[model samples]
Target: MRDAYHEELDALTDRLVEMTRLVRSAISRATTALLDSDLQLAESVISHDEEVDRIFAEIEASIFDLMARQQPVAVDLRTIVVALRMGTDLERMGDLAEHVAKVARLRHPDSAIPPEIRSTILEMGQIAERLITKTGSCIASRDVESALELEADDDAMDRLHRRLFKILMADDWKYGVEPAIDVTLIGRYYERYADHAVRVAQDVVYLVTGSRTQDADLR
Candidate 1:
């Protein structure tokens, strides 16, 4: 029975890893669709979000079942609890990606980001991809060091977000209110995506060391 319970725990971890991997793909594709004005790809991302939602439901159910049956203790208990939160984070990341794709689909053949600051948006997307993929590694390995690193990784996304605001606030800006709103929303989506990734990594730190993420780095 002990071995079986451990296996169930391992299965839970595997599910989270898989979910994170899918989130990484979703954000990457969504970024590409936004930049390229690829309506077909954007539509694909929006529709496929259902899969992420389904997986989220499955993970939640698994956690409840594990808690009721196994009564997991110590680190095991932490793992289960953290997995539930991380699953939500990953699911939210997926939704952010879908939101990006929705903007792309709404704009259709015209790129959502204008030419002046497209590179900045591209960089933000790149940072997002890196943050989420590293988050998956941190979760799978319980690598506290790597998890801590996400904080600084998130700083890059934050910087890009500030840059977007600077551009929008500049006196020379000609894109008008509508495009400014688009840039603002897109930048926010990317920033929030990175924030969620960092949160998942932080949860991984908590799972591994039984310390809050903020305290985990002190060791």
Candidate 2:
């Protein structure tokens, strides 16, 4: 029975790793679609969101089953709990990617922001993508130190988000209110994606070190 339980746990971890890969791919493709104004790729990302949702449900069911059957304790219990939390974060990240795709589709061939603002938006997307990839690696490797590094990476995203806002709100604005609103919402989607990735890393830290970190300072 113990050996069977171990096998189930390992399977759960493997499924999570797979889910992480899908979420990362969604982020990458969604960002590329936005930057390149590729409606087809953006549509693909939007359609694939259902797969992420399915994986979330699978992970949750597996965790609940393990808890009821094996009655995990100590580190084992922590692993299950952390897996559920990580799944939630990953799902949210996937949803944010879809949101980016929606924005791209809404704008179609033309980008919502001008060239200057588009550049800033691209930079924000890149930072968010990097953090998402690193957070996945930290979780898979169970590297507490690397997880802490992700916190700093998230800080960079926050800085870029604020910078983008400052540019949007400046008195020199020429894009008009509608374009400004689109760009602002896109920046928000990217920022929220990074925020959830940071949360996943924090959950990993809790799993390994048994403690939670400070809440993100949104100011």
Candidate 3:
């Protein structure tokens, strides 16, 4: 029975890793669609969100089963609980990617952002993707050190987010209100994406080190 329980737990971990990979891919593709102004790719990302949702549901069910059947205690309980939290974070990350895709579709034929701002958004997207990938690695390896490093990376993303805002606000009188609103919303989405990834990393830290790190301030 113990052997079977362990096997099931391992399978759950694999599924969580797979879900993370799917979300990371969605984020990357959504950004690529935005950069290349590929409406088709954006549509694809939007459609793929359903799959992410389905995976989240499945992971939740698995976690419930593990809890009911195995009655995991101590570290095992932490691992299962962390997996549940990480799945929730990954699902939210997928939704954010879908939101970006929707923005891409709305700005079709004409990019939503000015050329000058596009590079910065792209950089933010890259950092968000890195954080997602790093969170997945931390979960798979159960490496608290890697999880801490992922939190540090969020600092760089936060700085970039702030810097983008400075540029957006500096010449805001020249650009109309709609463009400014769009830029602000886009920055919020990326920032929130990073925040979610950081939360997942923190959960991993708790799972491995058995200590909760400081909670990330999402705002």
Candidate 4:
């Protein structure tokens, strides 16, 4: 019975890690679709989001069943709690990626990003991919140090986010209002996606160290 119970707990970790992988791919493809204005890729990202949602739902059900039947304690209890939090954040990250894909679909053949801001948006996407990739490593390895490094990558995303606004607000800006709004929303989606990845990493830190970082505390 003990062996079976522990196996269930291990399964929760496996599910969470799987979620990380799905969301990571979602964001990567969404970024490419946004940059290239590929409607097919954007639709793919949007449609595949249901798979990430399904995995998170399973994680929640398993956590509840474990709590009710096994009455997990100590580290096992932490695993359940942290897994719940991580799953929630990963699900949100998937939604954010879908949102980015929707923006690309809305613009169709014309890229949502302007020529002036395209490179910045590209960098933000790259940073987002890097952050989530590291986030997956943290989830699988339970490496607090690697998890903590996600913050710096998130900082880079934020910088690019602010740069987007600066470009939109510049005197030479001539893309007009609709394009500006699209860029703003797209920047926000990337920024929020990175934020959620940071939250997942912070949860990893809490899972291992039992102490929340200052940013995690704010969450």
- Best candidate per lDDT, number? 4
- As for candidate 1, its clashing pairs are none
What lDDT does the true structure give each of the candidates? 0.88, 0.83, 0.84, 0.89
TM-score of 2: 0.93
Query: Clashing residue pairs, candidate 3?
Result: none
Per-candidate clash tally: 0, 0, 0, 0
The full ranking of all candidates by TM-score, starting with the best, is 4, 1, 2, 3
lDDT at position 17, candidate 3: 85
For model 4, the local distance difference test gives: 0.89
Candidate 4 C-alpha error for residue 10, in Å: 1.2
TM-score of every model versus the real structure: 0.95, 0.93, 0.92, 0.95
Clashing pairs in 4: none
Q: Write the per-residue lDDT of candidate 3 for residues 106-167, one digit (tens) a residue.
A: 98987777776788889989998899898889879988777778766788888988987888
Query: Please, what are the lDDT tens digits per residue for candidate 2 over residues 119-178?
Result: 777777778878877887877788888877877777888888988889888999888988
Residue range 111-130, candidate 4, lDDT tens digits: 88788987898898889889
Model 3 regions more than 4 Å off: 213-219
- For residue 92, model 3's alpha carbon misses the true position, in angstroms, by 0.4
